[model samples]
Target: MGKSHVLVIPFPAQGHVIPMMELSQRLIEQGVKVTFVNTEVIHNKIVTSNWINKDGVDDDLRHMVSIPDGLDPCEDRNDIVKLAKSISQNMPGKFEELIESVDKEDDTKITCIIADFNMAWAIRVAKKKGIKPAAFWSASVITLASVLSVEKLIDDGIINEKGMVLKDEMIRLSDSMLPMKPTNMFWVCFEDPALSEVAFQIVLAAKQASELTEWVLCNSTTELEAATFSMYPQLSPIGPLLASNRLADQTGHFWKEDTTCLAWLDQQPACSVIYIAFGSFTLFNQNQFEELAFGLELSNKPFLWVVRPGMTKETATIFPDGYMERIGSRGKIVSWAPQQKVLAHPSVACFVSHCGWNSTLEGVTNGLPFLCWPYFSDQFQDETYICDIWKTGLGLNKDERGIITREEIKSKIEVLFNNGMFRANALDIKEKVASSIAKGGCSHSNFNKFFEWIHEKDS
Candidate 1:
């Protein structure tokens, strides 16, 4: 190949796509050509507003292509189980055709195929086409480690092959792993038996995908998950793959950000604003939603909250009567806030987040402590680390009803602000994270190592 070139395919979701896009930009910076592929639905939504005018995606360095995800227009793309089933079954042939067409059209043969860990079938497709394939896990390596250990969990009788816990027991995968309850796991409550089984199948696919790859690129730093990295020697941590200042304005958003939030932050006193946003998938019950609103009101602190539509169970986001006028300018709520921007603002004291891996990393990167009210899955795991291992944040305990009341929210915000200890710890992690992604840092060196592999002849 004249120049190292790779085709990057991400499982179509906001969290997954953004990091892959960032990785593409990084590769472009290192003189590699990238054909960034997306599902036709996502491609059509993002093509105009995001990539075309984005600074890092230049004509000569990178290109965009899309294939059908096999989801009908009427289907819910956010339905995790359905999305997994449809894409896994329908897209293999379409992806194979796209790869063939790209090879035929480009003078330079594609050197590598980097696919999301969820898309295990891509490895087979790549092997058939005479290209190298690598797995990319977009979440925290720590979380992926838990996932990769599911089989071991089954072997030890902690969980079955289907990821069902054998009984109501506390289980530990490794000494470094957090103690997990049998019932609550991953990012959300899998209380629904049907949903849990389907969710487990997706994890099985991701694990199989991991075993097939000799190379793996993760959107995390070794500093973030040292023990996890030691356990899995193949994973290469080269992330916190944020869009730098040059690409910041251009990086695409699945939802339009309310730019007004920036000005709102300006009016708040330093370190007085609490920033809240649950990433793409966390849904709140009507009770949870009203409680969150009441909690924000009780805090008496300036805040910015991102409430995306469909975030609530019923899609009803109505506030209590006189809710806006009561707080006036003290609180600002938007359908979507420019999260990276809001977190980095000087006035933002802490984050009331769902503890999604991306949100966790962003909070750490910004030196802000967390109010961890994890809704489900690996988030509960992440909360253990933030509160126990890292000592960088406080988690809100659920009430007798298993709900985090307004008082709990208010209390956590007070704890983060009234105390200097956790804030100091968060800043320390921030320094380490920033240094890792900086020039001559660990992630940068790892990126070089990864690039060297990309340039090598395929076996």
Candidate 2:
């Protein structure tokens, strides 16, 4: 048999792209040929940001390619529903064309397709071309279970065919699974009813396509969600798929990471810095932004904050009056940060996070307790795991005005810091995560099996 060649595609968002890239890296290490696909926009951002060539060494086994997402240049990519619609309408044909072109150029024809669960349509495309299809889920196993259980949810009268929650209540998929709010269901979390319905349709399509997949790989471990993994025995966990596990820098970042913060972190005392970062999609109004700034100041502890370019809706991220001067050298603010390294820094005490899955895994692996301030979708579910299930984090509460005030932030910091159990629990979870990725561990064994499957010849 010739070399095992695979085409890997992610859902085009940063959170999805990063883990898929990490998985691609593992494939490259095993001497497999990989074609990593991204949308044109995402491809440009990653290449221009210098992430692909950061080390100045290119891997011959891996190739990065881009396909149109079916949106015009001026279209708003941030609108999830619109992006989903465009991708569903346009990508399959473009993807098939790319595969044909690739086959004409490369001797090792594409043998398999590994697609993000959200982009399961590609699995059908693979099947049409006589290629093996595998689904990759970058979020929690329970979240995947929830999406896959759409029919069960509908049969139970919890949600309708369109994913609308008929009854507003908490639900448990099984006796062993944790309870989840209907409003927190991934499809229904959007505030706009129309958008929610569209998202529901996209999810339904994904579920149907996912049924054609031969393997379902998840970026989680049984140690973290034992019951959920046990409930769906087919969903294989081969993660916390971090670059740190291989001692490499992470790739697939849309923004260039500022490494200067590492120098500043070096100067701080051990476990003294409050690290705050919300992932790419989070946005805040000016009032809330100022409250967060003031709250960090109120803590009076050293801090490192990732204030992304569009973090706030305002034209500029305006801080409180004289805020920079008042805080002085105690805080470091960067547009984007190297989060994995930042969390691994000994000077960092805990995470004030938006609870995105990538951030959750990064914080947990680094043994940092969390102050969860989730914005939307799956984030609330992750917070439940952190605060309620694992007891390794605390959730920040909002006031009657729907604002998380400076006082609330300050108080949570105080409460989190005053308690030692949170840190201890975090450390314990960290150890389990490390063990899972080590030799003879669950994730390690699963990954080995996946590797073998990827190389297996057709009967």
On lDDT, the candidate that comes out on top is 2
Q: Which stretches of candidate 1 lie above 4 Å from their native place?
A: 48-58, 182-184, 187-189, 247-252
lDDT of 1 by residue, 317-350 (tens): 7787899999889889899877888888999999
Worst lDDT 10-window in candidate 1: 49-58
How far out, in Å, is residue 309 in model 2?
Answer: 0.7
Q: Total backbone clashes of model 1?
A: 8
Per-residue accuracy of model 2 over 135-217 as CA lDDT, tens digit each: 99998887888898999999999998889999998999999999999999888999898889987886787789888987888
In model 2, the runs with Cα more than 4 Å from the true position are 53-57, 246-248
TM-score of each: 0.94, 0.97
